[model samples]
Target: MQDYSEKVQVIHNEKFGRHLVAQLDIEAGDTLVEERPLLVAPHWECGQMKCAKCLQESYVMCRSCKMFPLCMDCQGHDDFECQFFASGGPGGYICKDLLVKNYGVCALMKFLLLLEDPSTRKDCERLLETPINLDDYRDGDGMWQEHEELAVRPLMASGLLMSLTQAQSLTADDLHAYCIRIDSYSFEVTARDGDTLKGVFVCGSLPHHCVPNTVVALDEEFNLKLYAAVDLKSGEVIYNSYTNPLMGTSQRQHQLRLTRRLECSCSRCLDPTECGTNMSSVKCRECPDGYALCELSSGGDWRCSKCSAILPAADVHELLAELGGALVEAKGELQAFESLLAQYKTLLHPNHFLMLDIKQNIASILRATALMNCMDQPSKKLLARRVELCSELLPICRAVVPGISKLYAIALFEYLLSLIELVELQFSEGELNKKEYATHLKTGRLVAKEAMDLLRFEPENSSEGYLVERLAMELERIESDIAKYGR
Candidate 1:
């Protein structure tokens, strides 16, 4: 018998290059791998104070280098100080002038500092050897060149680099290669306390797919956890959706092309109907009952399945663009968005991104009501109606976003919360019998359990990430209610 317990193995091809394939039958929610990051430092965008040791947001600043913060747990540790001083910049006292430039510059500086260690430098050199196509870097995009000069080159020239024998003779070209590697492989790692940092997982081998079968999230320890989102057969290739799975095929392809410099040829990308969900399809102007699907080939026209009438790509583009503008206009306005959802329902498929977008907006509105202090009868009714809308969205979400994605977890959480809210509203109004209340409470518990399981690894900073605590409370409350009812 074949040994399928190896978990995953690396496979290479001319088309997809190096990617991970499952070596065993894996069920959804099963942990595939846990990888410790090679390097972790603050992102250029976040200026928040975090522990230099673990990246936790709650911390005390280092006495010498005021810029570097350390948690109480890491403080007074001789080893930590020795490592910091060896890093060079954390050697002397830091002033405001140096502190202001501590954003992306420090991350790069840390990379240079790590190179001073023989073991870490060897791993970094291995990372630099990873193949990257030059075409991914656009000449028109000055950001890459700017980062290379401001962050990369400066770090290469710093005393930190000169102190390391391995990195001492590093050239600008070598620095440019490191920059590319960082841009390509770095994952945004967020700590349990909401502190965020960017790091590269040198040991991971997962590759991108338009519709991913796996979900990756950071654990409390900042190690990357990979889970099988769907049941994986032995020898199947594992794929991670690099872009948002909620996005339509055209949008996903466009994003991958711009960012990864490659058009996806995944089954979903090749299918115009997007695996029969009709997510990218729109109402055909030529026929009432028929929907138009874009031709699979590029520059191909959208044609109605019923009437055989074709619409040019330009016309379809203009229509979607108009709907996109309307979506933006209705952003925070509930009534306007409700009307837009109805209007788009007539013009697009139920599973279209625009329709889903409005549904999500409505769900957000309902989810927020769970936190409301008071709810009158009318407010409760509105909440109930929106809850129904959220229920309708679940099947589509499950079909496309099968994994433990934020969207899937959020929808499940919102639906469960709405159920709990409705039960409470009814109980307060003397409308729910013990039997009826118990039923809803039981359903809420099950849904909450599933959602919590799905979002177990979600970062604490995300909108729905904090729901785990609330969900736990709701489930506990529901179980008590069920016990009181003798269920």
Candidate 2:
């Protein structure tokens, strides 16, 4: 096995076949690994015009082929006769044109192209030859059987194999084995332009967890950096959440089986209340208080911990569907959003997924208002309320997503901006005391700095990148004002 770094080592076990474990004590926010993507593709169904090579916005097409879009720098590179292009001098063939429109086909094509390199091809073959324990994916459980017949068989027959290999052919069994490799080790690549693509990282061999201890960040070039979400002890297993961190336990498990093709027995998945976050809980109709805790078992009832109020599984699903519809229609309308919030206030816990959805929607409105520079009475009130809402959400975000996650970073930026504006508004009206103003200024500086710390890893031209620059300028202006004025 190829060693990624001194901080982590590869290990194999019966439950999770191959995973990474910490070698030394690591601090929170410490970088554990940095791996480049083995393959990258345009965002799935992304209709935006982009450079085929660099993935940046480009209007320039290859003059000879008129088929492939190229950024100026990539077009100017002298190695036009490289492996990516056909042998012709100027009108060389573009290899990527073989796969387009579909993200899965495109990504797979890129992976095959990567294997054309002798060194990478050898590494991939060796990695696939290593045996993995499949006791978790047995035939009797309906997991392995369904996956083989449905997913694996269809992919092998899809003609992607014949196209990429350039005349080389592989059997269904060969493709099936490769599918296992891809599903087990692939990373979801997020580009600098906010496009999401499936990527295979050269050193992305991490274990699975419903609540991961580490988080991954990527740059414009798709180079990945892993950061410790919490302080790590030596020899502890490092885990990555393959699914969204905010997903309820049951929802996460279902999604995981479809993607990772394994049943999760992680600590959070086994817990009824998801480690006391109550993310999957719903308020009992019979009981005035106490939430009905959901279980993974089909026969298991959402039994109220406090009372004997039983919620039928079907009813919970119905409520969730209704909540999704309401949230979708509540966009950009404060009254509709507030009504839904009021309705769900009693139907779900404060930290439940529904409530979080409403809070996030409200935050979006506040962000728009802040950007509009609207300081009318109602807008100022909204801004103050937003500051409180964000303050509440930030601690919860830190508790669950304890690293430099994009959501946490964005929330921090919005919160700092709101605070900065609120303080300025108060000062303009001469209603701010010097001490209080200074405190707000100091808090803004600290939060903005933290947000920037995370945003520095993002692409410069991306939305996060623009936010970082704006926040930095605001922070600098705040400091200058503080220096010029007393207190």
User: In model 1, where do residues sit more than 4 Å from their true spots?
Assistant: 1-5, 27-29, 56-73, 76-99, 142-146, 153-163, 169-173, 403-407, 432-434, 452-469, 483-487
How many clashes in each candidate? 0, 0
Q: Model 1 Cα displacement at 114 (Å)? A: 2.5
Please list all clashing residue pairs in model 1, or write none if there are none.
none
lDDT per residue as tens, model 1, 327-390: 8988678788889888878888888877887888877776666567567667888778777887
Q: Model 1, residue 147: what's the lDDT?
A: 68
TM-score of structure candidate 1: 0.85
Superposed by TM-score, candidate 1 places the C-alpha of residue 299 at a distance from the truth, in angstroms, of: 2.8
> Relative to the true structure, how large is the alpha-carbon lDDT of every model?
0.71, 0.68
